[model samples]
Target: MLGLLQRCLVRQGQRSLHSGRPALMAVSSDSGVGTTQNLSESDIHQDIDKRVKKSKVVVFMKGTKEQPQCGFSNAVVQIFRMHGVDDFDTVNVLQNEGIRQGIKTYSKWPTIPQVFLDGEFIGGCDIMIQMHRSGELGETLRKAGIESQISDPPAAKDTTEETTPSTSSTNVKS
Candidate 1:
């Protein structure tokens, strides 16, 4: 009997997971209310978990690359810059109503500006700076086969400068 009750409760929670409503221990008074009425914590957690594991480098911040909503987020960007990162992905948790809360649960880090490298949770802004200072960041990049901008100059700029001829002319017609 106890097992049957537990299964029923689980089903109810799953049904309400995506409805944007809090999961209740007791059944709602209205049986007409459907799962669409509310979303459970499990739904939010699943959303965050899928994103964290989806990319090689993922930054869960307050804002996107163009605009960071918090000082901590900006600091994370700067640290990545120092390490010469040419490509990375950012998730603006502030924009997502669910992600802002979900990410904390997913990472169990209790903070925004979380950084992940090669699908592994690295840490937040402070950790990033510390790793860069210790030179571990560069080593990690190499191990992941991720080329850093610090190690290699911009190829396009270098090639252009090399191919372009000098505009100034020293030769004079007599």
Candidate 2:
């Protein structure tokens, strides 16, 4: 399990390594998730819809999985890694203002680091933390078609590094 955890972290780090951050070539959405140019609100909604549906597990967060922009996001990412969820996708909400706000409206949850399982909103960091703490996250992941890969439910690990910003934690609106 520890090997799995490390591998996930390493993969997360590598994912951001090759992202071509060139200036927006066309009208593409700020978040790189969209395949087309900047879109209308409805179109953005469609993009988001497509995004969540594309993967069994996805997180709409402040930054990419390689580098989470907030401590809460890091924590959530870590929790997912600890649970052996290495194949999940993440959207960097900070990259696109529309996505940042759009996701809030899409999920009707006021927060970044939003999680989706099987195309359903699983809530934000707070809810994920609650699920992780109560040992429900593992079961939820398995039920959602993501493999838990653990013989027993493991505890959530704090992956927030030293420089992790000092801000309100999960569930605390800051």
Candidate 3:
């Protein structure tokens, strides 16, 4: 009887991992009977969908926005900032198991730091930085109607200042 309860608990935990909802198994003290909670698989699927579509630019990385766990993720964020992008979202893949696996399958890229721009997969850090350096990133932003300003030096301004004529006196005579 005790062995059966242990098995049931393990099964419930596994279900929760995939279902995204804790499987409630009610075990009566005297009766030693258990009841399982029923959760639809669609419920989990829909939640993942909503999370993925919530942001314009979503980066699924190893860590949080404040601290990126991986070097690749750090580099990607830095490049985005250098491109003058202040608005974007990040998903710490380390936090969610489903998202971590689902994103790799969704993007068809087996990498931790995956970047998505405007709901489209934008590849990894190397590809993004390459595009950014080649000026294609700005073009892509324009295509998305994001209106990102490329770094351009401010034009020099002309300042008119009064100049006094210089007079030089010869050694002998002026």
Models 1 onward score TM values of: 0.60, 0.67, 0.58
Tens digit of lDDT per residue, candidate 2, span 84-172? Answer: 78888888776677787888888888878899999999988778777876778888887877777544555567676746886776785
Residue 9 in model 1: lDDT: 38
Candidate 2 C-alpha error for residue 54, in Å: 0.9
The top-ranked prediction according to lDDT is 2
**Total backbone collisions, model 1:** 6
lDDT by residue for model 3 over 121-165, one digit each (tens)? 889877876776667777887787766577433444555442555
Q: All models: lDDT?
A: 0.64, 0.73, 0.62
Rank ordering of all candidates by lDDT, starting from the highest: 2, 1, 3
Ranking of all candidate structures by their TM-score, best first: 2, 1, 3
lDDT of 1: 0.64
Query: Which ranges of candidate 3 are over 4 A from the true structure?
Result: 1-48, 151-174
Give per-residue lDDT, candidate 1, residue 104.
Answer: 78
TM-score of 1: 0.60
Candidate 2 stretches with Cα past 4 Å from truth are: 1-31, 34-37, 150-174
